[model samples]
Structures are given as structure tokens and as C-alpha cells.
Target: MIVGMNMENQVLIVEDEDSLSSYLKTELTFENYDVLVAGDGEEAMTEFTEHQDTLGVVLLDWMIPKLNGLEVLRRIRKQTATLPVIFMTARDYVGDKVAGLDNGADDYITKPFEIEELLARLRVIFRHEAQQLQVAPVYEIANLKLDTKSHQVTRDDSHVQLTQREYTLLLYLLQHKEETVTRDELLDNVWGVDFVGQTNIVDVYIRYLRNKVDRDHTPELIHTIRGVGYTLREEE
Candidate 1:
């Protein structure tokens, strides 16, 4: 079981829009999340300070009153760097996305995005954090390591952050290390039978894993078998 998963199901929604905030609170509550709302930046900080320990995630709007979302996020980061914060903004510029990420947002969603997608992102953040807090085992290859106890990946002992999906995909590859595992096998095991629509997801995630786990490292561990699939093994 994921440690702290059940203990931290609360989320703070920092949006000034009444109708949208109310609607979101109702929706999230229905999905079993303890909902908290702060109409502006100051209130956002107050709510967060009070519930910092219990809070699992934060959904912050970019144009909130008093401090603005960016300022609020900065302040929150000072208090705690590990708390997950996702920016909800109307801005979709590449620069704006980079700024938010640089300012410590774990994710970003444009104003018109589907609620299901937002919920999905929240679930991913929760899963990742919960897994990080657990105590388990460690797997290693070359200079890379994955600690199941903390759900953290490290290269030469330096920490690497991964989303829940990416972590799961990596875990599966490690379990089948040194074997050329097929995409179909990966989808069946990693994405599961319910995964429909595309087969390229495995490829996409493999690329993601490479960028994080192998890019700058020597003796790259993840290898593609061309027409076959992929493998995780030490290459001499």
C-alpha cells in the first residue's frame, strides 16, 4: 500500500471565480477529495498554511487577486518544496509554460481543458507523492538506481523526478531487465488491457525514460531492439 495515500486526499483550489470554484469543489468532493477554496492569493496562503500537513495537492489559478498565482506559488515553494502545485491558467504560450514550471508548478492546464484530464493529472501527482513516501526495496543497473521504498529514480545518486506513469513504466522494464520486451507486452503489462487507441504510448514513454535515465549517463541501460521492442540491461 502507498504510505500517506489515504492520509493526504485534500486539495486547495485557488480560483476567484465563484461558479467555477463551486463547481470544482462539488466535482472533486464527489471523487473523494477533501476540497478547500481560496478566492484570492492571500486566502490561498492562509488556507495552505493551516492545512499544509494534510494537503496533498494544489490547483492554482494564474490571475488570482492580491498576490497572483505566480507569487502565491513562490511563497508556497519557500514554505515547502515538495508540495505538488498545478497551475490553471488561460495563458498557453510556451514561455508562460516554462515560467510556471520554473517557478515550481508540477503541471499546467489551460482554462478550457476537460475536467477529466485535470482529475487524471491530480491522480498522477497523488500517486507519485504517495509512492515517494513509502518504504520498500531498491533496484540498480550501472550507475542508475530506483528505490521502491521511496519510488525515486537516481542517476549516479542524483535524484530524478518522474510522473507516476513514467515510474510504473520504468519499474516494469527493470523487472524484465536484459530481456527484449515487446510493445504489446509492455502495453498489456504497463498500460494494461484497458489501454486503447494507440500503441505509440510505449514508445513515447520509453523516450521519456531515456531522456531522464540514460541521456547523460555512460553505458546507457535502455535499448531499443528495432523491430522487436525494448530492453533494460547493462551494456558493456
Candidate 2:
């Protein structure tokens, strides 16, 4: 059992299949996670709303009843854009996986997965979230400041709005300022080591951060390392 498990570390399982849902609940509970089960999209949303503050992550089945997984994720994103969501689907198609990620899933696992792997993935997500919480409330570099407690970023006197993923990515870069951080490193630290998707996700989010943090700003703090990776440092 997990030591010191609490409501704040709870996980929500949204799966319509009776056998699978029960198995997940039992396994998660065995691991000492406060588990909440919902058998359909509607129920999932209801449970999410009721326990949003307590939920640490969501394990959502792709083909759930009433609203489908993507729709449920869409609604969830509207409410809390940063809430971690993992899509569980039997479909092995890359297109489906891409759609899920594009629609807001933080990760996706093909069905018939081993429970051990799932547990490991959950641990990674939880670890990353905990690390973020422990970060200093404010980080500043060359007039750019990030406030972890407020979830806000500003340059000079201008505020910059970012999606949760973007904010996390930028924070990671700032944490490793001046050092070239590889795509694999970013994937492992920011997206989790179990993440099984395109590495281009790093590039995509880098573009996003650059647009918001540096496009119109001076002394562009984010820099490409040319064939190596990327770095965040004041221009030389």
C-alpha cells in the first residue's frame, strides 16, 4: 500500500466495462490510491466535477458510453486544462493516438496492458506533479519571471498566458537554464518516461513557448542548440 496516500493523491477511473473497471479499482485501491469509479462519460464528468480538487489523475477509457472519451476529455479541459489524463484504448492506430493527444490527453496506453506498467506510469505522473508542487514559487531569468504558485508568466511588465503543458515545458527549460536539454530528457521529465508517442511533441511545445515568451520580447531566453537540443539562457 502507498504510504501517506490521501484524497489529494486520488485517481479517477472512467471505464464502461464492468470487469475492467472493477479490476482497475481493485488494483488501484490495493496500491493505496483513493479510487473513484465511473461507468460512463456522464458519470465520469459528474465524478470529476465533484472531486476535481482531490483528483490527482484520470484514467479514461476511449470508447465509454454516452459521451466518448474524447468528448469527456474536451469537457474536462474546458474546466481544468492542466489535469493529467491518460487515455486507455484498444485501438492501436497512430492516428487515434494522435487525435487523443491533440484533444488534451496527457498520455495514452493501448489496451490489454500489464497492470504493472500502468502502475509505473501512474507513479511517474504522480512524481512529476509532486516535483512541480515543491518547486520555488518564482523563477526569474533575464526579466522573465514564472510564478509556480500563481501559474503565471511575465516578461518585463507584460503577462504571458500559457496552456498547462506549455507552462510545464517552459518551467522545465528554466529549471535547466543554460544547459542543453535533449528531446529524450524533456520527454522523460516532462511527459514521463513511459510516454510512448512522437518526440516532435517537444518541438511543438518549444515553438509554443517561443511564440508566447520570446516572439515579441527581447534577449530571447530560449535557444536552439543546433543538432544537440535546446537551451534556455540569456543571449551572449
Candidate 3:
């Protein structure tokens, strides 16, 4: 879907309204997501069954040509044990939203929703799923082992203790190893866009990462590129 992104995640949109389904498909595709459109509840179920492994989330409409939203949600919940499903309906009534969530929908987004809001919700769902999708994140370079899932790091059989901010910062740097990562990019992505602070946060975290992961090492792992940003790599 998105260039350079893993297509292991898929989203299904079930809406009988051809116009609405097409619009969603286009918008999601532009965001680099693998999206499938199902015209009705039955079709949605079929797609879900076929792509269960890769189906990360679903957007189900309230009324469809073949089966109604509630019935579809019931069938999906019975079939999909831990799959995330979001209800999309024109009915903005509080009762309808409550009913949908009570019946197992992960979230209920009313129709005429803001595109940005929908994207934000999808991001949250995907991130939550990703955390559960991986058992561990063990990244290694040379004699060092970084266990992001466990928040632990070890070098040459010796345990390296790091603060929460340091661990998170190192993991982020390691994930994008060898790339020049900007301070603003780090602030926005790591702490979230709404982080009520300045880019100095990145500097503070970088210092922490340096102390824990690089101080005793021979060749520096984290390199500061003047006028640009930082890079984490094995290269000198």
C-alpha cells in the first residue's frame, strides 16, 4: 500500500453505498493502505474470512443491501476473535453509537466524519494492534543486543540499564538506523504531534541514549550531523 510499508496489514470497508465505498477506498489507498471494499455484510464476511490473517481493521456501515449492520457485527464478532472493527453509520444518535460499541465494535464513527479524524482513529487502532502483533523486538548490531519489547539492552553479555526515555529514544533511532533523522521528526513521531514542548526534548533524549548505549563503545554509534540531524549506524 504505502511505499516502503509492509502490506501485512489490510483494512476492509463494508458499505453498500457504491459512492461512499469508492470514496473510502480512494482515500485509504492514498494513505498507503491495503483496503478492500465489500458491498454488503455477507460480502464483508467473505472477505474477512479470506484475508483474516492480514485484515487489520474493518469499517462497517449501519445499513447494507444484504444484511444490516448489527447482524453483520454479531456475525463478525462470532467469527473474528480479536479483530478490530469500527462502525460507520449515518445515524448519529447516541443510542446507535452506544449500541454498536456495546455489541463489540472497537469504535463508532458517524457519517460525514472528518477525514483527518478518521485517519487518526485508524492510526491508533493500527498502533495498538502492532504492539500485540510482535512478541519481541530484538535488534542486534555487532556485540550489542537491543530488546525493545522488553525495554532491555545488553552488550557483550553485560546488561545495560537505561531510563524509559533513553530506551524509547534508542529504539527509535535503531529502527531507522543509518538514516539522518531530524529533531523535529523525532519530537513529532515519538512524543506525538501534540507534544506541548520544543525540539530540545530530542537533544535531552539523545544525550540519554548516548550515555546508556554508546559511552563505553569504541566507535560512536550515534552520529550528529551538523546543520542536518542525527544518524545511528555502525559506520564511522
TM agreement with the true structure for every prediction: 0.63, 0.86, 0.54
Where does model 1 exceed 4 Å of error? 1-7, 74-82, 101-104, 123-135, 158-217, 222-232
- Maximum-lDDT candidate: 2
Per-model root-mean-square deviation over C-alphas: 5.4, 4.5, 12.1
Candidate 1 overall lDDT versus native: 0.79
Expressed as tens digits, the lDDT of each residue in 78-100 for candidate 3 is: 65434667788999786786587
lDDT of 2 by residue, 1-236 (tens): 11111226799999999999999999999999999999999999999889887788899999989999999998988776567789999999988987887776777889999999899889987886677677556888998998776666889878776655676788899889989999999988887777767888899789878988999889989999888789999984
Best-to-worst order by TM-score is: 2, 1, 3
Error of 1 at 163 (Å): 7.1
Q: Which stretches of candidate 2 lie above 4 Å from their native place?
A: 1-7, 155-164, 215-219
Q: Which candidate should be chosen as best, given TM-score against the real structure?
A: 2
Ranking by lDDT: 2, 1, 3
Q: Compared to the true structure, candidate 3 yields what TM-score?
A: 0.54
Whole-model lDDT values for every prediction: 0.79, 0.83, 0.72
Worst 10 residues of 1 by lDDT: 1-10
Clashing pairs in 1: 136-149
